[model samples]
Target: MSAAAAATARDALRAATDAIHARLHGLPALQALAEGRIGRAGYVALLRRLLGFHAAVEAALADAPSLGPSLIPWGIDIAQRRRAGLIEADLATLGAALGASAGPVPLAPLPALGTVPRALGCLYVTEGSTLGGRQLARALDGLLPPGEAGRRFLLGHGARHGAMWRACCAALEHCGAEPARRAEMLAAAEATFLAFEAWFAGAP
Candidate 1:
């Protein structure tokens, strides 16, 4: 396909996934997190959930040859985006604040990804969340204690956030997922979104 056609295909995929994406964005639990209403532990719980889910996703990508390509950018390795480590540090801080141990974090429920399309779908939701995370991190900056400990996960990819998200989009564009793959991707994205919303809903 030509450039225009590729852009059209990407747009179509976005349109297919848009409704579920909007719903996830509008979830009450996510709103509370972004609105900075949740305390430090509540924020840590959110990161723990993300860490679990991402651990699953990244592990799959690392083991699956096809899926790994879907995440590898032009030059970076998958570890660069596997941001659970950042979350763990923040969890340690939050745990200390609560006078509790930080090492044993509860993992979020895993989303199924037996196929590359499904994996990409999950990646779409996860990477897209980072875009919104930049904003959420700022909101949290004021609410959390004066340090990077709490918002490190939100500030993931660091100064390269915009570039990393662009890379994610480029990866999607290159997938050249036909209509069927797009549908599978959309389903995966929807399920992933639902899982995250539910996780946050049940958080303390």
Candidate 2:
């Protein structure tokens, strides 16, 4: 088999979603966050928006009964990896500091994660987000209060980030080993990325 043919599921996903990932990077809000140009208000807005997305995504994962079982064999636990509450706490902290309400945020419409492969695809995009978040968290050092208070979501798994990501990759590889399953994973990942792009672009 050629090198490409022998590539792992994670490699295939990275290749398939490269363009979408680039587009996500180009988003104004995300660009501003990465460049450390988005002020506190902008950061707060971004966090609120992120909370909505994470909440919706986690809800989907929770609602899918079979998803948990599918992931168990791969040593993945959706519960341990959830960050929606972190976002909420961050928002609350920032909001309280600003003497404003961290009120309800809007949720994005998600495609159905009816199958394990499809759900894993969504997890691929969400989980991979943490790798880039470390840098994004750094960009917030001077912007936010120099601690994990209002940036917990961005900080992610902290020292465990690397290990957590490796585990996620293993799960993706195991689940996507089959060509048919890999295709579903790719499609769902593409859809999830697009959902993020649209959510970030729309009014928060």
Candidate 3:
């Protein structure tokens, strides 16, 4: 990528990161608006907001040319999976955090959540890093013929994703909330992003 293009990509990434942080800060307030405890209605509203935010973040990623090809596909795949109910387990964990005793709530069943946009942006950001890292590792491995440095790079990149994913999981466990509940999910999402940021900064 051209230096200008790379700079633009970095800026876009930072903006997405900032946006995710902003949403994280806003979660408690949104949760309060949901009656201080998340229920079906509250969860629905939160999901809508998250979805909208995700869409915007995805758009920003689309504008970033520095991202590797794997990044885009990985992002699209995750979004599709979520839409296709693949995130049921994670969603259920979130539901439990929100005091939901029921199992995975279908996205189709939650109209309120569909009406707003929120966590989708952060989701995309995580996926972008994951995909980009994977692509970089693959390229390096191909070029270097499987040296320790290449292996280390791949491992580091994968670790970043793992840390972020774990952070998300931890956040869910922290709140005992449902997937559709924006406040808790956003907090968890923020944890995920921060973990990724830390990992990125520490990488060689």
Candidate 4:
């Protein structure tokens, strides 16, 4: 595909998911957390939910090996991108800080990843989330105790965040080069966003 064609598919993805992406920002818990208005309990609850979401999504992506070809050449290492563990650790720290267990975090239900593009679509949502995580990490400065104990998930890949995101975007463009694959990716992306919104909204 030419540069112009690649740009168009990338734009198509952004255009398709833009509305739902905006809606995710409007989620009360997420909005409050982003604005630094959430208290300890609320913060913990938010992390618990996020842990569920990331844990499920990342696990599904891990099980899909076909994504390796499109991703590896772009420097996108799936293992390096796993964030559920960070979230789990953060929860443990928060729980320990309170002299209690974080308990079990339920996994958020996600759309089926039946194809490579569908799997990529799911990855797109989770990986792209790290960009916002950087800002959210800053918003959490005074919330967690000193050091990076409970905010590791938000801190994400730290300095590597930008590079990882760029690589992921490039991989996405490559996968979207084929129109059929692009449609599958877009549909799955939309489904992922909707599922996320529903889960975060307290729906089962």
In terms of lDDT, the best-performing candidate is 2
Q: Superposing all C-alpha atoms, what RMSD in Å does each candidate have to the true structure?
A: 4.4, 2.8, 17.9, 3.7
Question: Across residues 53-157, which tens digit of lDDT does each residue of candidate 4 receive?
Answer: 888887777667776554676556778889888877887787733233745557788898757788778878888788788788778776876667888988888
- 3 or 4, greater by lDDT: 4
Per-residue lDDT tens digits of candidate 3, residues 99-173?
A: 356443222111111111123334534444344434433543323445433223223334345665544334323
Tens-digit lDDT track of model 2 for 1-204: 321364888777877788889998888889998998888888877887887898899888888888888788886888988998888788778763223373455678888887888888998999899988878988987777777888788888888888888888888888888888888988899899989888887854
- Point out the worst 10-residue segment of candidate 4 by lDDT: 96-105
Over 4 Å off, model 2: 1-6, 96-104
Best by TM-score: 2
Model 4 stretches astray by more than 4 angstroms: 1-6, 65-75, 96-104
Cα lDDT of model 1 overall?
Answer: 0.67
Clashing pairs in 4: none
Worst 10 residues of 2 by lDDT: 96-105
Model 3, global lDDT: 0.36
TM-score of each: 0.76, 0.90, 0.27, 0.86
Q: How close to the true structure is residue 106 of candidate 2, measured as C-alpha lDDT?
A: 65
